[model samples]
Target: MTQLNNVGIIKKANIYFNGKVTSRTVLFPDGTKKTLGIMLPGEYEFSTDLKEEMEIISGKLEYKLSGHDWVTIDGSGIFYVPANESFQLKVHTVADYCCSYLNE
Candidate 1:
């Protein structure tokens, strides 16, 4: 989906990597949450406390999960990061993404 509807967003931004990466917390009505964010051209590493579904909305980038090779996702794609793991990204362009925190 291009847009999110009927959701609550936290006002404060999630800033990281000296503001190279940022996102907002999106609260859903069904006790679920997600993050809508953007990544500028840079390399970044992130750790997840929960299982996350990373949906690439636009732009180009390569991501590497723990114990996996770097995979490129250009234009749009989806990848999952397991709970309690780390991942890396090489953002080639400004990328828009939506990350869903999954329970299973």
Candidate 2:
């Protein structure tokens, strides 16, 4: 296993949805790879390339999975977005969030 100590702020990332989404690749302690993201106020559509995600921070959000019902989230919460599922997120206000991806 490997470790990162006192790492600084992110320097590289990809932006989507007119800057509503930002993605960055990071290395984990177990020597694995992960992708992290930050979503701001806007409407967005995404599909996961991995099996699941673990939310690190959360706030109010509106979402809908492909062909599924829409839902809203409030406060700090953690949830999973299944792999290969297309989903959309609509932010009512400014929000800060992060999530860890599985299998890249």
Best by TM-score: 1
Candidate 1 has its poorest 10 consecutive residues by lDDT at 1-10
Give the distance in Å from residue 23's predicted Cα in candidate 1 to where it truly belongs.
Answer: 0.5
- Overall lDDT per candidate, in order of appearance: 0.96, 0.68
Model 2 / residue 26 / CA error / Å: 1.9
Global local distance difference test of model 2 = 0.68
Taking the tens digit of each residue's C-alpha lDDT, what string does model 2 give over 6-103? Answer: 44335688788777777776765665555567777778777887766646355678878777888777865666778888778787766666566666
Encode model 1's per-residue lDDT on 1-104: one tens digit a residue: 36788999999999998888999999999989999999999999999999999999999999999999999999999999999999999999999999999998
Judge candidate 1 against the unseen true structure and give its global Cα lDDT, from 0 to 1: 0.96
How high is each candidate's TM-score? 0.95, 0.73
